[model samples]
Target: MHKYYLTHLQELESEAIYIIREVVAQFDRPAILFSGGKDSIVVTHLAKKAFWPAKIPMPLIHIDTGHNFPETMEFRDKLVENLGVQLIVGSVQESIDKGRAVEESGINASRNELQIVTLLDSIESHKIDAAIGGARRDEEKARAKERFFSHRDEFGQWDPKNQRPELWNIFNGRKRMGEHFRVFPISNWTEMDIWNYILQENIAIPSLYFAHQRDAVYRDNTWLPASEFLQLREGETIENKLMRFRTLGDITITGGIESDADTLEKIVAEVSATRSTERGNRSDDKRSDTSMEDRKKQGYF
Candidate 1:
């Protein structure tokens, strides 16, 4: 008989590292999609481990909606400086100013949808043949079907119905010129796995993830951050809530949930007991049942 020990988190980490190495070996100019979010930070750490003797051989690309939390931006800068890695930012503000994307006009207007154009433009301008993101399978129904090596067309469009099958560990990254792939090394991780990894590795994340008191407006069943981008519309209630962001996006649309999970252990407990998915706080997904699918088809990451 063979002796064995089972640790789910360790197995997942090993798989993620293997995918990271495959990205470096297969793509010509691959870049990581870092958003200062917990998942992205985990992917960055895995990439670091994948190439311990040598530095992580890729840049990080962030599609800044320009309404991100100040703490997230601070974390992004600090991580880049500490890791000595190149950081590239795609600004939605610049895209709007250049008329490449128009700002939506409404009380709940957000740049969440507008980010797609800027992201695709950034990818094209940089000639990034492969982009590594931190999307997980358990995050959403649409994402659950994603493979580690998801392909995109010349225009960066995703065809959900037509994805390559992965029978084993072999990945088919072959694509014609002007085509690319959006790789998700952590595609297999669930929320619990992420929290566990963060706890085990002692990884530092922005304080926004923890519960804290902040001024928020209760609208669209979410605690929208009281930023300049968000306004107090008629019949809206403002309150001082103890909230923590489940997922980070444009300040106008990313919602906060009431919680007191102020530590990693507490967060793990919270997510373990949670009912809804992380993207549930996002109103952009509420635009339509297939909202994420529609945007991802147009190159939204």
Candidate 2:
């Protein structure tokens, strides 16, 4: 008899693949919430491997905030073309124009909270029963309470108190009509695990993750990329710095950290030694102590 063991990366890969397959088996119409971020990129990669020799079964859904990085858009288009999968975009600008979602105001305003309405609208419009996301438990306090298969109400809101139990690796995806589910395939993966797997698989990611010279400004104790959407405060000034993003989001809120880790291996090593959470740079999470939790409850991803 021979005994074999899987490495840490392989185990995580296997677990994610299993969850993805379950979405296919359990839901009628499932789609991936692709944001072109590293976590979503890894989830999309696992989807490719989950159904190899054939095209991915579900379409990729993107809730466009109209504040994206140019690099992220380019990478998203290229990846969609290469994968030969359908891409569905839900535009927040359209939502605002149609009076569906109202944009916030003030110096710290962002489209982050506005994404909730756009996402729920897209879900309802597409009749998507299972919306697969790349949210990890280790990212935030709200995400830590999520299950492998999280259920949502008819209004697309999550009830933390009313969640299903998953014992012995079993998941219950039962839901009523007019209700949907948010499935997280990589819920168990951590930031370090994601980088390790990306390095091991030699996955292609957006250029924003690498160290490069960019115009940025220090705001709220984080280096925010200088963009047209940004309105400078009285004493604010932009300066060129070698920086990289640990996480990617709207250009207005996603902050960058000073780093020289341009390669995948270097990123892995940097992540391993970092002390902050991957989402720590995101200004959206800094709104309040329960910011993410409130968003999740209101159907934000």
Candidate 3:
């Protein structure tokens, strides 16, 4: 007798593909939110695999905070061109210029929160009924409560307590007009799972993920990249250090950790031995315990 069972990675892949297909079937217009981060890259790859021989049926959406790393923008353009997929950029700078959103003040202020307005405006302009993202439950406490098919209001607001439940593999994507949904295909994947999948598939990630020498400052117990967008505090001093970003976001607030894990194998080993969550180094999350929750409530991606 022979019994067949899928490995953990295979299971995750299968689940994600199924979610992608469901989005195609359920929504009139759907798009994958591509941030050029590892998670979004994996999500886009799954979308590609989900509909082989046929190009992915949806465009990729990017909410550009305008404070992005140059490397991230380069990667985004190259990937979109290689895939031959449509790319939509929602510019926070445009939102600010148009007075739809205001920039935060002070040295620690980041445009991370301002992205919500641009994201919603883009969704409305494009008439996208569903937006697929690479968000994972294990990344944060607020995200942990997100459903595979998360429902949003006409204003794109997310009510965590009112989310639809997923039983077995069944997902309900029902919503009213002027409203939309946020679909997370990789919601079940973990940091280790992402690294392992990337390693297994030999996916290309930004060079910032690997160890390199960069000018950074130690603040709030994390290595904040020293960029022109970053406003240094009084006591902070820029110094060259070997570091790698555990996660990517606005350059102003995203922090890196000191490490020499240049190769994927070393990165996997480092992740396995680490005791901190990936978002621990993110200054945006450090603002308050409920910062992510509050943002999600206001329709942040």
Clashing pairs counted in every model:
0, 0, 0
Q: After superposing candidate 1, which stretches have Cα over 4 Å from the reference?
A: 1-3
Itemize residue pairs with steric clashes in candidate 1: none
Q: Residue by residue across 1-301, what tens digits does model 1's lDDT show?
A: 3558558888899999999999999989999999888999999999999999788899999999989889999999999998889999999999999999999897657888888889889999999999999998888777888888989999899999999998688999999999999999898888888998999999999999999999998877779988777778889877999999988877778899999999999998999999888888888889887777888888876
Clash list (residue pairs), candidate 3: none
Query: Which scores better on lDDT, 1 or 2?
Result: 2
Per-residue lDDT value at 99 in model 3: 100
lDDT of the candidates, in the order given? 0.89, 0.93, 0.93
In terms of lDDT, the poorest run of 10 residues in model 2 is 1-10
Deviation (Å) of 178 in candidate 3: 0.6
Candidate 3 per-residue C-alpha lDDT over 106-154 given as tens digits, one digit per residue, 9 for 90 to 100: 7667899899999999999999999999999999999999899999999
- In the range 1-301, model 2's lDDT, one tens digit per residue, is 2558888789889999999999999999999999989999999999999999888999999999999999999999999999999999999999999999999999889999999999999999999999999999999988999999999999999999988888776778888998999999899999888998898899999999999999999987789999999999999999999999999999999999999999998998898898888788898998799899899999997
